[model samples]
Target: MRKLSMAVLVLFLLTSFGIAEAAGSYWQRMAHGYPNQLVVYEYVYEYVSPELEITARVPQLAGASDVNWQDEFNASIRQEVQDLVASLQEAALESLELEQVFQAFPYVGIMDFEVKLNRGGLLSLAIVTYTFTGGAHGMTYYDYINVDLTTGRRLAFTDLFDTEAEIARAAQVINEKIAQEPEWYFIDQFTPGLIAADQGFFLTESQAVICFGLYELAPYAAGIQEFPVSAP
Candidate 1:
């Protein structure tokens, strides 16, 4: 038993060292602007595995710039920022043309990410949260990406698990957790069976975290609900 334990430890150490070597180094880049009087944008983006170009296997993360994940990510952010700025400019111009005095036309958009896990030739997970100001309140949403370090491709749910069984298990766990705080969710909207393929999720060392976006299963006041299910 001691031998087995020692072997496992050695393997873990080796894996960690390899990932560190392969990933090289990364840096954060910030893009900010108040392109017009009405808009405010600040985004801090990450360049992971900067020295290695890996094509993102995941369809959502894949793009023409597949060979360079940083470029792909920056391009997406730039497009979003441009779109937001254009909208804000148009609104400001319309308000001017209409001879209306604007009280509050504040626009705020932020993008942040967390590296959840990286091991075993897998950049296990990254969760990017985008929060923007619009309507009565600011809204935040998440995007989950699991990548193969070797191929630089994003992974889908099927690539990570036995889809049906794991989803069922995870849903069961989430339902039980939510039941403990029933008032936090809309009973009708919060059904375990409703857990879908496209839901946002990431992994910890021993658990799978399933997340529901704001108002998906509850009121926005309840915020985002995450339930962690023990990994099999």
Candidate 2:
């Protein structure tokens, strides 16, 4: 099979959400030649054959507040796509015997992203990818990318909290939500030590939404266990 050029890849997906042009809205910018409003264009890569199928939908950004940050972020996404391709390819090869036994089709792999929050001087995104190599179900992964527009710095969960106590309180809020439906989650696996300072999280106007991977704290039906806690 042949690989598609960047121009052809861009033709696959390109969209922009309306921005009110509000004052100090970092996510609202003239990106990718958009005179107004923030723009997000997806860079797609697909490879298909009788034995394997892999695709990655990476978000491409341009004309951000900081050129340096934009370059690094875009490069990072590309690298992630490359790594996924390589890893999935290896897994497909390793599972060749299992594939034949199960009479399965090509090993499938997919990667995509979502703009969870994009405003109020913060740009939060969720990168999601899935892979299935001869199994009853495919596995999913999540990566949260939060950017501080004013400084072009990557923000972590701790960065949003004023003090350690606030972070602990945020954890408490998440635990309380889990308590409501305790059976849906692996409550025992969720301990205080599990609250890593740089865990996956996105942001809203008033809440810092926590992110968890598939089967990390719950089953696949539970989806992503996101808890929104108060934060600036």
Candidate 3:
């Protein structure tokens, strides 16, 4: 366990310094009245062994007007990466045991992030993780980090919608959308639970994308269901 901790620490140290297999990209978005372009780097970490492999990629921004936003976003993502590595380490132990007993496939964990939206004075990043521990197939999960470019405030459902009426209205929209394709979703999962204060979402030019994970509202075949709500 101590050795594993040391390895995770080393992984963090390496990724914190713009150390990615591939160099970062450039993003041009709207900020105030002018064009805003920021450099995007992949904060990557990797651990490979006989029993398991883990790779993490979080997008880090540079050249933003708000330095505080950049620092806070970086810190929060680093913590998330740390927690994921620890969780994967624990899962890998069980996977190793299962592999020896059942002769199953080795474990694999991967996390990557991308710029999902950058408009309307808001920036949304999508982070996804996939893990396979001797299963029929791997499971994928998602987390989104959204920020207000003007105030550098982290935005949530509450921040986007001001009142319960707005929330209910949004849910109604989602419900209607789901009804349009009832065969592809689970009513019980998305009915009353459609809108939450901290739901995964991203902004676009005209609407906000509300996200659902695999099997949350439908079968894995449906993939992650993203419903668009007219941006508020």
lDDT tens digits, residues 44-69, model 1?
Answer: 32322211111121112322223476
Any runs in candidate 1 off by more than 4 Å, and if so which?
1-70, 77-80, 87-104, 124-135, 188-193
Better of 1 and 2 by TM-score: 2
> Between which residue pairs do clashes occur in model 3?
none
Question: CA shift at 196, candidate 1, in angstroms?
Answer: 2.5
How do the residues 1-232 of candidate 2 rate in per-residue lDDT, one tens digit apiece?
1356765555443222222233323322312123323456799999986667888898977667667877888898999988888887777777775546324467788999998666554577888988877658888888888876546678877666547677678778878888888899987435556887678888665567887877878899999888887643
Model 1: number of clashes? Answer: 5
TM-scores of all candidate predictions against the true structure? 0.60, 0.76, 0.74
Alpha-carbon local distance difference test for all models: 0.52, 0.71, 0.70
Candidate 2: give the clashing pairs.
none
> TM-score: which candidate is best?
2
Q: What's the lDDT of the predicted structure labeled candidate 3?
A: 0.70
The runs of at least 3 residues in candidate 3 whose Cα sits more than 4 Å from the true structure, single-residue gaps closed, are 1-34, 66-69, 97-104, 188-193
The local distance difference test score of model 2 is: 0.71
Q: Candidate 3: deviation at residue 186, Å?
A: 2.0
